[model samples]
Target: MNLGDLAYPDVPTDAVHLLPLGATEPHGPHGPLSTDTIISVGICERAAERLEGEIPVLVLPAVAYGVTRYGSAFAGAVSISEETLRSLVGEIAEAVGALVLVNSHFEPEQVETLRSTGLPLLDLTRRRNAERLTEEFRAGSCHAGRYETSLVLAERPELVHADRMTALEERRVDMPAAIRAGRTDFVAMGMEQAYCGAPGEASAEEGSETFETLATMLVELIREVAA
Candidate 1:
């Protein structure tokens, strides 16, 4: 059930609450600005469906802004301070004591901020979780590449700029490595078009499969807490 769709009296106290955490940032020229948000919501919704008979689930409204400092060079990139994000998340977590964070944005600051909340989080940046995802994602170059593009394609195909996606070439910049080396933004990390990985090779079939993995991971996390 969606928390936003429920009245005060209808809210379930025993259900595991999912808070979709995402960012509003540029996803190259082919992907939508809300790519991260879309993916987070997709994972939460899918997980909620899977947990229906096993455990009650309530998906909260998405928090669509995060510490997106890497995309700062882009026009559409919007970010909040880590302190601010931590405070906001802390408040939300306090209110919904059984909440779990389902995040799609992988920026370092964002990851750190979410971790500071001490809430159960499905952080895809971790090796164990990242390894379960597609190869492109594990390589850490999938900012708006095949992995993310495939997710967007699976969740919201109409939002993808097909013309631009088809015309683009693969950019294999190791974003995580570059960030570790002190690269501040997409431009510094050699992401000229604000994207990396093989976006041209993205397919909805791969996306659907990836979503299943993500949802499964979320469900497992919820079960660990709900138990």
Candidate 2:
């Protein structure tokens, strides 16, 4: 049951409560700042659809703000502290029967905050065939690249500017190296527009395939955690 549709939740006692997390951060010159939220929601929605007859789930409204201190210096980025996100997620999880966290933003501090919640969160960023997808991208960078841009194309096409999503392959930057080097914004990493990886190669079909893999992982996670 969708929580938003109810005046009072008529949720089944055994239903899983999935909280999708997103961030108001820059993706690239062509991608919207809400890319995190949009893709997270699409992943959650597909996962829920996959589990429809197996275990009922309530997909909660997404948390649109998060700790992105590493990218905070970018024009379209906004970040909160890890402590703030931890506190909020913990408090919210307390009210659910079975809880799962679905997030797309992979910032170090944000990921650490979510894991430290000690609340059995389900994040597909590190799981799923996520490794394979990231490996397919340039030096494992996913931000505003083919992977993410494809996801947005599949989920919310209007938000992606196809014309601008071109030739970002030239701007390959190793995000992990940048993080290790303590650089915050894209400009510092030789990516002036805050995007990384190949965008010209992104297609809606690829996005659909990515979600199929991620949603399968989600299903496995829910079964394990809810066991």
lDDT of each: 0.91, 0.80
**Highest TM-score, which number?**
1
The parts of candidate 2 lying over 4 Å away from their true place are: 125-129, 167-169
Off by over 4 Å in 1: none
TM-score of each: 0.98, 0.92
Give lDDT tens digits, candidate 2, residues 54-94: 88887888999998865666786788888789888988888
**Per-residue lDDT of model 1, residues 152-179, tens digit only:** 9998999998989988899989887798
What TM-score should be assigned to candidate 1?
Answer: 0.98
TM-score of 2: 0.92
Backbone clash pairs for candidate 2 read none
